[model samples]
Target: MKQGIHPDYHKVVFQDSSTGYKFMSSSTKGSDETIEWEDGNTYPLIRVEISSDSHPFYTGKQKFTQADGAVDRFNKKYGLSNN
Candidate 1:
Protein backbone atom coordinates (compact mmCIF):
# COMPACT_ATOMS: atom_id res chain seq x y z
CA MET A 1 0.00 0.00 0.00
CA LYS A 2 3.02 2.27 0.45
CA GLN A 3 4.56 4.13 -2.51
CA GLY A 4 8.26 4.35 -3.44
CA ILE A 5 9.11 1.81 -0.74
CA HIS A 6 8.99 -1.40 -2.81
CA PRO A 7 11.53 -2.80 -5.26
CA ASP A 8 10.70 -2.60 -8.94
CA TYR A 9 8.97 -5.79 -10.03
CA HIS A 10 8.68 -6.55 -13.72
CA LYS A 11 8.67 -9.31 -16.28
CA VAL A 12 11.94 -11.02 -16.97
CA VAL A 13 13.17 -14.08 -18.84
CA PHE A 14 14.96 -16.79 -16.97
CA GLN A 15 17.31 -19.03 -18.92
CA ASP A 16 18.66 -22.31 -17.69
CA SER A 17 22.36 -22.17 -18.46
CA SER A 18 22.86 -25.92 -18.75
CA THR A 19 19.77 -26.81 -20.75
CA GLY A 20 19.29 -23.48 -22.49
CA TYR A 21 15.64 -23.54 -21.52
CA LYS A 22 13.90 -20.18 -21.13
CA PHE A 23 10.72 -18.94 -19.52
CA MET A 24 9.25 -15.59 -18.60
CA SER A 25 8.34 -14.56 -15.08
CA SER A 26 8.08 -11.45 -12.97
CA SER A 27 10.69 -10.55 -10.41
CA THR A 28 12.25 -7.61 -8.60
CA LYS A 29 15.62 -8.51 -10.03
CA GLY A 30 16.98 -6.67 -13.06
CA SER A 31 19.80 -7.23 -15.54
CA ASP A 32 21.56 -5.35 -18.33
CA GLU A 33 21.12 -8.28 -20.71
CA THR A 34 17.96 -8.39 -22.82
CA ILE A 35 16.19 -11.01 -24.89
CA GLU A 36 13.48 -10.98 -27.53
CA TRP A 37 10.66 -13.25 -26.45
CA GLU A 38 8.25 -15.18 -28.66
CA ASP A 39 5.71 -12.40 -28.16
CA GLY A 40 8.02 -9.98 -29.99
CA ASN A 41 8.73 -8.18 -26.76
CA THR A 42 12.12 -7.59 -25.20
CA TYR A 43 12.67 -8.39 -21.53
CA PRO A 44 15.62 -8.52 -19.22
CA LEU A 45 17.56 -11.77 -19.43
CA ILE A 46 18.41 -13.56 -16.22
CA ARG A 47 20.60 -16.65 -16.37
CA VAL A 48 20.20 -19.42 -13.83
CA GLU A 49 22.22 -22.55 -13.28
CA ILE A 50 19.30 -24.91 -12.74
CA SER A 51 15.59 -24.96 -13.54
CA SER A 52 12.79 -27.55 -13.78
CA ASP A 53 13.96 -28.52 -17.25
CA SER A 54 17.39 -29.63 -16.04
CA HIS A 55 16.65 -30.43 -12.40
CA PRO A 56 17.06 -34.06 -11.38
CA PHE A 57 13.81 -34.20 -9.42
CA TYR A 58 11.68 -32.82 -12.24
CA THR A 59 13.46 -34.88 -14.93
CA GLY A 60 13.13 -38.12 -12.94
CA LYS A 61 16.90 -38.51 -12.92
CA GLN A 62 17.25 -38.06 -9.18
CA LYS A 63 19.08 -40.78 -7.27
CA PHE A 64 17.65 -41.76 -3.90
CA THR A 65 19.81 -43.41 -1.25
CA GLN A 66 18.15 -46.28 0.59
CA ALA A 67 18.47 -45.61 4.27
CA ASP A 68 18.16 -48.42 6.79
CA GLY A 69 15.75 -48.22 9.72
CA ALA A 70 17.00 -46.68 12.92
CA VAL A 71 17.14 -50.03 14.80
CA ASP A 72 18.99 -51.71 11.97
CA ARG A 73 21.45 -48.84 11.69
CA PHE A 74 22.11 -48.90 15.44
CA ASN A 75 22.71 -52.65 15.41
CA LYS A 76 24.99 -52.43 12.43
CA LYS A 77 26.96 -49.62 13.99
CA TYR A 78 27.46 -51.50 17.29
CA GLY A 79 28.01 -54.89 15.67
CA LEU A 80 25.17 -56.34 17.76
CA SER A 81 22.89 -59.21 16.73
CA ASN A 82 19.36 -58.39 15.67
CA ASN A 83 17.86 -61.02 17.99
Candidate 2:
Protein backbone atom coordinates (compact mmCIF):
# COMPACT_ATOMS: atom_id res chain seq x y z
CA MET A 1 0.00 0.00 0.00
CA LYS A 2 1.30 3.41 -0.96
CA GLN A 3 0.46 6.47 1.11
CA GLY A 4 0.30 9.96 -0.41
CA ILE A 5 1.19 13.06 1.57
CA HIS A 6 -1.41 15.74 2.20
CA PRO A 7 -1.33 18.60 -0.26
CA ASP A 8 -1.79 22.18 0.92
CA TYR A 9 -4.76 23.98 -0.62
CA HIS A 10 -4.64 27.80 -0.91
CA LYS A 11 -7.86 28.50 -2.71
CA VAL A 12 -9.55 31.89 -2.50
CA VAL A 13 -13.21 31.92 -3.42
CA PHE A 14 -14.54 35.08 -5.02
CA GLN A 15 -18.06 36.31 -5.66
CA ASP A 16 -17.56 35.32 -9.27
CA SER A 17 -15.97 31.92 -9.65
CA SER A 18 -17.68 30.98 -12.84
CA THR A 19 -15.62 29.95 -15.81
CA GLY A 20 -16.05 31.79 -19.12
CA TYR A 21 -17.34 34.73 -17.08
CA LYS A 22 -18.64 37.49 -19.30
CA PHE A 23 -19.21 41.10 -18.31
CA MET A 24 -21.51 43.54 -20.05
CA SER A 25 -19.35 46.41 -21.26
CA SER A 26 -19.37 48.76 -24.24
CA SER A 27 -16.26 47.10 -25.59
CA THR A 28 -14.37 43.89 -24.95
CA LYS A 29 -11.97 43.83 -22.02
CA GLY A 30 -8.61 42.48 -23.07
CA SER A 31 -7.42 41.10 -19.71
CA ASP A 32 -8.11 44.49 -18.17
CA GLU A 33 -10.43 45.83 -15.44
CA THR A 34 -8.98 44.74 -12.13
CA ILE A 35 -11.34 44.46 -9.19
CA GLU A 36 -10.01 44.80 -5.64
CA TRP A 37 -11.14 41.93 -3.50
CA GLU A 38 -11.98 41.98 0.18
CA ASP A 39 -8.35 41.10 0.86
CA GLY A 40 -7.24 44.24 -0.96
CA ASN A 41 -6.14 42.49 -4.15
CA THR A 42 -6.91 42.72 -7.86
CA TYR A 43 -7.56 40.11 -10.54
CA PRO A 44 -8.61 39.80 -14.17
CA LEU A 45 -12.22 39.28 -15.17
CA ILE A 46 -12.18 37.79 -18.68
CA ARG A 47 -9.79 35.43 -20.39
CA VAL A 48 -8.98 34.46 -23.99
CA GLU A 49 -11.18 36.27 -26.52
CA ILE A 50 -11.06 33.69 -29.30
CA SER A 51 -10.93 30.49 -27.30
CA SER A 52 -13.71 27.84 -27.41
CA ASP A 53 -15.61 30.54 -29.25
CA SER A 54 -15.65 32.01 -32.75
CA HIS A 55 -11.94 31.72 -33.56
CA PRO A 56 -9.79 30.46 -36.42
CA PHE A 57 -8.02 27.82 -34.37
CA TYR A 58 -11.13 26.39 -32.76
CA THR A 59 -13.70 26.92 -35.50
CA GLY A 60 -11.22 26.42 -38.32
CA LYS A 61 -11.99 29.84 -39.76
CA GLN A 62 -9.35 31.75 -41.67
CA LYS A 63 -9.27 35.51 -41.25
CA PHE A 64 -7.42 37.64 -43.77
CA THR A 65 -5.39 40.63 -42.63
CA GLN A 66 -5.49 43.51 -45.09
CA ALA A 67 -2.32 45.55 -44.95
CA ASP A 68 -1.06 48.28 -47.29
CA GLY A 69 1.65 47.18 -49.76
CA ALA A 70 1.62 43.60 -48.47
CA VAL A 71 1.64 41.99 -51.91
CA ASP A 72 4.27 44.43 -53.19
CA ARG A 73 6.67 43.45 -50.41
CA PHE A 74 6.21 39.75 -51.13
CA ASN A 75 6.86 40.23 -54.83
CA LYS A 76 10.01 42.30 -54.14
CA LYS A 77 11.43 39.69 -51.77
CA TYR A 78 10.80 36.85 -54.26
CA GLY A 79 12.71 38.74 -56.93
CA LEU A 80 9.53 39.11 -58.99
CA SER A 81 8.68 42.24 -60.95
CA ASN A 82 5.97 44.21 -59.13
CA ASN A 83 4.68 45.81 -62.29
TM-score of each: 0.86, 0.22
Judged by whole-model lDDT over C-alpha atoms, candidate 2 comes out at: 0.48
- C-alpha lDDT of all candidate models, in order: 0.95, 0.48
What are the per-residue Cα lDDT tens digits for candidate 1 across 1-83?
Answer: 89999998999999999999999999999999999999999999999999999999999999886566776888888999957
For 1-83, candidate 2 gives per-residue lDDT tens digits of 35566443332322223344333232222444455545665544444344434546656687767665788788788988936
lDDT of 1: 0.95
Which lDDT value does model 1 have at 36? 99
Q: How many residue pairs clash in each candidate?
A: 0, 0
Q: In model 1, which residue pairs have backbone atoms overlapping below 3 Å?
A: none
